[model samples]
Target chain A: MQFTCAKEDLLTAIGTVNRAASKMQKTILECILFSCGETGITLRATDIALSIKTEMNAQVEQTGDAAIPAKLLYEIIGRFPESDVTFKSVGENSMEISCLNSKVVLQQMDADEFPIFPALEDKEQIKLPQCVLRTMINQTLFAAAVNEDKPILTGLLFDIEPGSLTVVALDGYRMAVRRQAAISDIARKCVIPSRTLREVSRIISDTEENVKISISGNMALFEAGNTEIYTRLLEGEYINYKNLLPADCATSVKVETNMLKDSLERASILAREGNNNVVKFEISEKNLEITSNSEMGNIDEQIPVITEGKDLVIAFNAKYVLDVLKNVEESEVLMQYNTGVSPCVVKQENSDAYEYLILPVQLREE
Target chain B: MQFTCAKEDLLTAIGTVNRAASKMQKTILECILFSCGETGITLRATDIALSIKTEMNAQVEQTGDAAIPAKLLYEIIGRFPESDVTFKSVGENSMEISCLNSKVVLQQMDADEFPIFPALEDKEQIKLPQCVLRTMINQTLFAAAVNEDKPILTGLLFDIEPGSLTVVALDGYRMAVRRQAAISDIARKCVIPSRTLREVSRIISDTEENVKISISGNMALFEAGNTEIYTRLLEGEYINYKNLLPADCATSVKVETNMLKDSLERASILAREGNNNVVKFEISEKNLEITSNSEMGNIDEQIPVITEGKDLVIAFNAKYVLDVLKNVEESEVLMQYNTGVSPCVVKQENSDAYEYLILPVQLREE
Candidate 1:
């Protein structure tokens, strides 16, 4: 096998598949297949749960294939000069890499031992703008359960409807729901692991092109630019979170998102030291006060707000509220809730496209 | 304790003492004593090994001292607005801090429980440019022994003479010597722990002001910018490294430092996998060849060089050579060796202000 490519192009291709290869067993499993054929060079790596493959432009001298150690190949490519790097197979299972006047011979694994990448044929397909998909993933993935005790909760529910696509995730403490326009009108539902969504989103962020997703019975493939990523779907029954959200809220406060976020961040620093990072908010017609007391100290901050309905006092885990607040870019946010025992709903001032529900913690008066 | 100061000023003062307070015990030693008096505000912290203190201008309403947790104080002050912050003692062990509409009451330790910083005074002192002193420390400190197995090797020897000061450190495999003009006429010798020198260098780098060094008995103090740091000297007999350096050299090669450095870095990648990270260099009339072969692979790199004395081949730890090469800013570096078994001397082409000695490993030809 012999091929030459720009140092930067090879480096980027290696980095694209590095995450998938890192989790694979080093014995042949961690080897990335470098196939030099008619068009260019194709590289693939997999960790059973996920696989990524990328096609890069290169000058192919001889058409052949070899499996190189993913990590070592990346490190070596990273140090090559900003010129074309030539990779040529020498004797059996040995390869030589050259750039400018520098040359090195590295050992390679048997290409036969490497796993083949799956063909990403679409049984059902969905296409969306990369930026929009990435935003949807970011808004809801954080609410997914971190621990896999409940496998279903560790994934974000993809509820595809006739005209809209709704992504939702929930842990025991909070829930996040995001809705966006759908590219395809076919209605279907699937549970994709939060980790997979994060990886897909990360790949999509690198470019502004639309991502074409192909889903079969068990695996989903994401194709963006010259790269393709495949991840296994989580199989389980997801909880119906609609019943958990309260229908009526007695109190509603409209405050600038930045103002509320800043105050809560400072108050959370003190609350973080407590058993449960709970910060209490007292809302009235004119102003809102946030307070938290922990072993280290206490913080009391007040931000002006326009109130509606009834005056109320409620407490919540500062982290849950902060998570959703940071994702919001709007100027004002509406905080609506009933009695201290009900869930607090946070949404953009005039939009219902995104909703964050935080469960209130029972506060004991000292 | 009651005082008011700009948020930036207080944060800077706290940061100056943070390094010293972090090493102290958290129960009591971690507390930084905050003193508000007629003059201004004084803050101090100590870890027995090192102590730091700084004084800044602040409006004092009460003359009292309170020992506050160094980490907590810094964290809280970091979040305060850019306005003046008011700190007042509410009780014997609690203090209230307010800035704008934000307020918090934090617990403080008993002032009497905190360690008092020692007064640093010496009849003989040295004042040097912070940049020069920082450079001297960086060049020699890396050779200091990391473990205290041999306590003497852990400290860098500071040999101060009438007109010149020489600093040296050796870790069995290598030695680094740096010589510079003395800023003070009074000559005295001392051995400072490498860790102390690193900390002193770090503080010096934060400012462009001069650094004042004072040594008395077993303690040395470094005053840089607005911070004064005290450290206990490492008292012991240093190894006689002068006898280990070779006076005769049979082979020499002058090459671009950057070229040699880059080639060696790549070759070292393969060598690092072996039991010894040894890279062999062969010098000829116009070219130098570097090679390394390990279990993973082998790398051979060649670069142009100007040969002097006798052409020879030798092997040394690639890391040791890379360390000194990175410190050289000159275009070319001179590499000299007497024999394959003797130490190789590396220095700038025309300067003797700093010299690096690397011991070569006995290579067996296969």
Candidate 2:
């Protein structure tokens, strides 16, 4: 095939698809299969688990397919001329790329060597704005289990109802859940690998375009603009996350997000000396005190808060609280605790858009 | 001991000294011992191989010494207020630090457990400008071997002449040598470990002030600013690098540095597909052809050059050429080679400040 395309357009499309290319010992999977036809040139890469296919329009003359080394081809094309570049198939296993006064002959593999990407059945589909899904994934993905001991907990659980969709992830120690109004007519529940969610978030733009999501029994497909991403569903049962969150909290307090962030970060310096980097929060009528002690020393910070309840002191992993606080987009954050030993719930002061539940560490009695 | 110092100052000092601190299983070496007295506060850390000691002026109330955890103390101090912070030794193994409205008590170890820094004799010493030493180190250190398989190659060879000082480093594969004529003192030659050279470089500032360097037996001491850095020299015979560089070359070429850099970087993307990232250069009357061929593909680039010889071609590792080009401070670079298989010499067009010698890779006869 022969076609001319902008360097930047091809670079961006290849970059997105290259993320799915395997960097392991599998040589065949490391290549990006290129297909050029009258419509455009399509780049496809997969690791047998996740696949990405993106198409960009170009001046086409003939139809052909060539599989080039994904990383090297991307790097070379990225540094090539700023003007349009032409790609023409030379023979059975090679293609010539010319831009400006420079030309490169790239060795290729047969397109048939590329694994076939799974196609999702159109029966189960959901439509949602790109930003909505991106936001939900960001809020909950960090809480997913990194260890594969429990495979299901390594994925983000999606629960879809008639008008609301909730994304939840829990690592047994902590949990994050984000609920938003559904923008699709389909109601379904599925678990997506946290890594897939992260990759999708990186590729999805913040534009107002709606992304179409299709799912089969074991595969999930996300299509937006001229790009389509497919990932295999994690097969297992997710934990009952609702039961992990407290039903009612006895002590509640509201504080400025920035103020709490600064105080907690300072306390973290001392907390990091310990095994779990534990930091204690003591909520009083009008102030919130954060404290951490280690062999190096102890750090104590007092921040003003709006609270009207009995004084309570609780301890938790400082990193967990900081993660939730950094993800919440609000001026003030509300923290609720049932007791010193139970889990604490953190959310935006006046909204239930995103919530984080952290299990407190058992503290030694003074 | 007790004193109050600014958090910013403490953090900067700790960061500088912490570079020499070891994170290995040797716990005593990981601690930075602080001695507070009527004069000032002295912080010291040593890993037996190297030692760094600095004195910071502070408001000392009492005289005492304590060994504090380097990483933990640095982290805590870094996050404290930029304002003056009070540090007072409490009990036997604890210290309290107060800054603004926040206060932390850090557990400390016995100062007696800290090792004593090596002593330097007054007889053996060399005084040189800090800027000159820093420049010479930067130019030659990158060529030093990182692996300890050949301990001698892992150190920079120091050659001292009547009015000139030369530093050379080679990993047997590539070699870099730099010379400066500012020094007029007679000295012997020695080999200093690349790691020690790197640490000394980080601590030394580019100023007009002279730094005292003392080398006696197996240890080298550098006294600059308010800090004194001591490193154990490597004991081994260094290769005579002067014999490796050709005295006169037949074919020579001069090219613009920026243009060469761009061409090399572009060609490197394709060259990296090969085993050694080798690129071939064909030098003609008015043009230089750069090419790389691998199973992935072949790339060809033509750049204009000023040549004074018959047509000649040579192949070299792209990474070695790129490293030398990046480090050399010149607008135009001069390249001299005897033949396609001989060592190539790279330097500034007219200056003798620095020179890079790269061994050519044997190409297959086609």
On the 0 to 100 scale, the lDDT of residue A202 in model 1 is 75
Residue B339 lDDT (model 2): 93
Classify candidate 1 by CAPRI docking class.
Answer: medium
Chain A TM-score, prediction 2: 0.96
The two-chain DockQ for each candidate, comma-separated, is 0.68, 0.58
lDDT of 1 by residue, B1-366 (tens): 788889999998888787778644457778888888987998898888888888989998888988888887788889877899999999668999998878989888889877767775555687777888888899999888888789978988888776677889889889999988767777788889887887788767644567888888888888887678888988788877677767877888889998898998888888888637899998899999999988778988989998888888899889999999888668888898898888999987667788899999979878
Model no. 1, DockQ: 0.68
Query: Residue A275 in candidate 1 has what lDDT?
Result: 44
Give me the TM-scores for chain A across all models, comma-separated: 0.95, 0.96
lDDT per residue for candidate 1 within A1-366, as digits (tens), equals 898889999999988887788544447778788888987999988877889999999989899988888887788778877999999999888999999868989888889877877775556777778998999999899999999789989999988777677899999889998988867767778889887898788778745578877778888888899989988889988887678667887999999898788888888878988547899999899899999998877889988999998888888889999998998878898989889888999987778788899999998977
lDDT of 1 at A174: 94
State interface RMSD in Å for all models: 1.5, 1.6
| Native-to-model Cα distance after best TM-score fit, residue B174 in candidate 2, in Å | 2.5
